[model samples]
Target: MRAWLFSGLLVLLVGCATPAPDSLYQQLGGQTGITRIVEDMLLRAAADARIKQHFVEVDIVRVRDKLVEQLCELSGGPCIYSGDSMEESHTGLHISRSDFNALVELLQAAMDQQGVSVRAQNQLLAHLAPMRGEIIER
Candidate 1:
């Protein structure tokens, strides 16, 4: 009887054990992966006529770094975003809704190129979607 009870308890404990879920950071391949995504997005943006002008005089390297930081933090990674608020940074740029949408498309393409899963890409985009109001038409 004692042995049977011990076996049953062990089985119950094992059944209750579950692996932790992956954080968004892990789904995004962590820091190195996010860096690659940001770099790819920036390169594409620079060539896109509809939005390239916005980046003409900007510091590309700094923009890449800040984007990486922001993405990392938003995705539950270890980096913190040290850049200005979206509104503050875009205030003078007079961005339009189409411009914002184009940039989002660029980012989605970048993520696709990086082989990110569709669910992960959508999750990241959903997190960023709220910022559109802060970025367009200052």
Candidate 2:
């Protein structure tokens, strides 16, 4: 009886063990990983005909900087985003569902290229999903 109790207690303790710390930033390889993902995504977006027109008159460099900053902050990194709010920035753009989907595809491809795990990719996407209302006008 004592042996069975000891085994049960051991199993319980093991079951209660804490999970490893897994912040989105750390899972994404921190600042360097984020920058690489952002750059790759931007390149893809710029090359895609479906969304390239949106950036025709925009400053690509500033956009990249803001993206990196925003992504970093969103992923629980040590960076702070000082850019405009999502709604304010995307206002008047009249972005449609297709446009948003294209950008998300580009981002997913970029994350895959950077070897970001699918779990982390999904985690990031989940966090960004709520911003759709702020970004999409149609």
- The prediction achieving the highest TM-score against the true structure is 1
Judged by whole-model lDDT over C-alpha atoms, candidate 2 comes out at: 0.88
Clashing pairs in 2: none
Candidate 1: what lDDT? 0.89
User: Ten residues in a row with the worst lDDT in model 1?
Assistant: 14-23
Per-candidate total of colliding backbone pairs: 0, 0
Cα lDDT of all candidates, in order? 0.89, 0.88
TM-score of each: 0.83, 0.82
Clash count for candidate 1 is 0
**Tens-place lDDT digits, model 2, residues 5-106:** 999999887654422248888788788889899999999988999998898888899999999888888887767899999899999998999999999999
Candidate 1 structure quality by residue, lDDT tens digits, 1-138: 999999999988765442124878778878888999999999999999999999999999999999999998898777879999999889989899999999999999999998999999999999999999999994
The 10 consecutive residues of candidate 2 with the worst lDDT sum are 12-21
Q: What lDDT score is found at residue 119 in candidate 1?
A: 98
